[model samples]
Target: MTTRRRAAPDATRRSEESRRAILAAAFDLVGQVGYARLSIEGIAARAGVGKQTIYRWWPSKGAVLFDAFLMLSEGETGRPALPDTGDLEADLKAVLRSTVAELNDPRYDEPMRALNTEILHDPALAAAYAERLDGPLKEAKKERLRSAQRAGELRADLDLDVAVEMVWGPLLNRWLQRSGPLTPHYADSIVETALNGLRRPTRRRRDQH
Candidate 1:
């Protein structure tokens, strides 16, 4: 009697092939036709797989697009993320710098831009966008904030929810609005203003110069 691996080399290769084809087709069709016209059927046809194969893995085009965008970014917004070296500002600057680099990648920008446009016009798609895109980024930002709080680098009284937004809100506003290209210096400014706040400090009698 002998035991054979259920996932044989051929089976594994086939699975990889299907996955690659699905992703490639999803990206290509979305890039070619735009999200409004993209269809599972078109994707399946382009991928050379049955529609059932796509459905078996992802429930909707939004899911596929979300994953494809993430793949394109190589998890820039979430996975393989922020380093905690006890310097809150340094860690955030590093993260934001990576973000700038990711947004500049050609593979990442178009599909994400398409998804963003769709999210604005459709409620269901908007919800999926939140779940897949915004939600993960929010969590990652929050975790970094918590580390900063723990280190006493950021104000302890800082509201975690608001603090997270404070750290990211301005940068995202610019990115989403296409207001301007973000620089590391811009991210650093956001961090400073968020942590130190907008008010100018009052003079202390002991510190007169």
Candidate 2:
């Protein structure tokens, strides 16, 4: 009988390092050159890997950029959860303000704009984006809403899916369309308005005769 040996731990670490390098290169290059000028050759050259290596892992430049954006969003801690400090309004405002800051940042602005452009045109990439990035983040948001619901902070019957969109959609649209400044004040207004609509309506008292 013959026994097969597992791959060495060093090999796995090297693979992980290479993957991170490729992702980082794609992220930085897109910011520098914009998405239209970004290519696998450039990414590979920047990453210190062969073009074939990138092709082996990703189907297209759009796909590479998508993963790169995902890695950047995840940071060193994998996926992030929405803040839940037991005060839904304050927590949501904090999250939205942070988002506004990122969107306004020069390092993130170009890369995110490029990712949004790709998602608009590529159906396959859009689907993957929804599945891998949007879906998880949306669910995390819904969970926070669910907590608010449990705490009676929101209407028990409130539709969480719509609620999430209501809070986030305006910020995204404003940024993408360049319609307005993405400031902390704008983020706070969004949270306040959305929460007002989502909360249980107050009953009016009868007028005195």
Candidate 3:
């Protein structure tokens, strides 16, 4: 009897390769041509796959773009965690500065703006964004805050969800609305202002007043 090997693994590998190619094509095309002009046909042509391939995996262009961005983020740094260097204020400043840099980067700026716009109108994409991208990042931020709480750097009673929002919301709003420049100075100011409200007051400081 001749032994026959299963081709399942090979097929799976090919499928995964195709998926990655599609995602990369979508990302590259969006960065090259703004989201307004991105199309399934363009992505399929660039990826060297049929239009049905993209549709089989993703429902719409927004879903493809979201996944493409998610893939880029994961490839860059596998679900980022906030730095907890024991000094909550300094750590937050560093993270915020990094965030400001990313927001200002041309490669990321347009794609991110497009994704945010999609989220507003596409409920399904919004849910997936929350679950896959935003949710994990928020939880990581909250964990850093919890560490600060445990170290007595932050108020024990501080609501972490609210605190996370307070630290990040303004910057997000500014970026989305184009109200102000996302500069390192703005990032530092945000950290300083948020820390003032969130930090546990010291007894010596209180005695001075």
Candidate 4:
């Protein structure tokens, strides 16, 4: 009896298709029915797969939406990314500008708000979302700050984690609290405030003279 080799490429292609379908279904359903009402069964039915198929890859509806949240947050490029120009201020400004745009976009804003609300009561879900979605860009920003410190552009004594938060926190506060509109001016001002505090001290004019 001859043994037949299984086709690895076919299996891989099918897996990609199924994953894409599942993500698409979750994204559409969340927008259509809101996050609280979305379910694995509903996603499975919409994706034309068994509920078991979803369970094979993810543990729960929250898990599925964690992946879906990543997709929604990626915008038209289908990737959530930050720029790295040699100038730290310019790079940070570009990213914050992108963020302001994302927050205001109807496609991302509504579903992201829904997801944020859902994660509050579920710590595990919140951690998963943070690890997958929030952590990378944050680490990248911190790394950029550290690079500036190395270049004598910023204070070496500053705690980078706190610095990163200083940049993110105000923007997030304004975004979530709805205290004010998220505009380019606000983003630029926030960046200026954070960066100014981090900049290296200059020699006093009197001392120089």
- Candidates 2 and 4 compared by TM-score, better number: 2
Q: Give the clashing pairs for model 2.
A: none
Per-residue CA lDDT of model 3 for 83-108, tens digit only, reads 88999888999999998999998888
Distance from true location, Cα of 84 in model 3, Å: 1.1
Model 2, poorest ten-residue lDDT window? 200-209
Q: Residues 130-173, candidate 4, lDDT per residue (tens digit)?
A: 78677876777777888888888889999888998999899887
Q: In model 4, state the lDDT of residue 185.
A: 85
Ranking by TM-score: 2, 3, 4, 1
CA lDDT of every candidate? 0.75, 0.88, 0.88, 0.80
TM-score for each candidate, following the candidate numbering: 0.72, 0.87, 0.87, 0.77
Give the Cα RMSD of candidate 2: 4.6
**Against the hidden true structure, what lDDT does model 1 obtain?**
0.75
- Candidate 4 lDDT at 23 equals 85
Worst 10 residues of 1 by lDDT: 72-81
Q: Model 2, range 105-180, lDDT digits (tens) per residue?
A: 8888899999998899889888989988888899999999999999999999988889899999999999999999
Q: Local error of candidate 3 at 85, Å?
A: 0.9
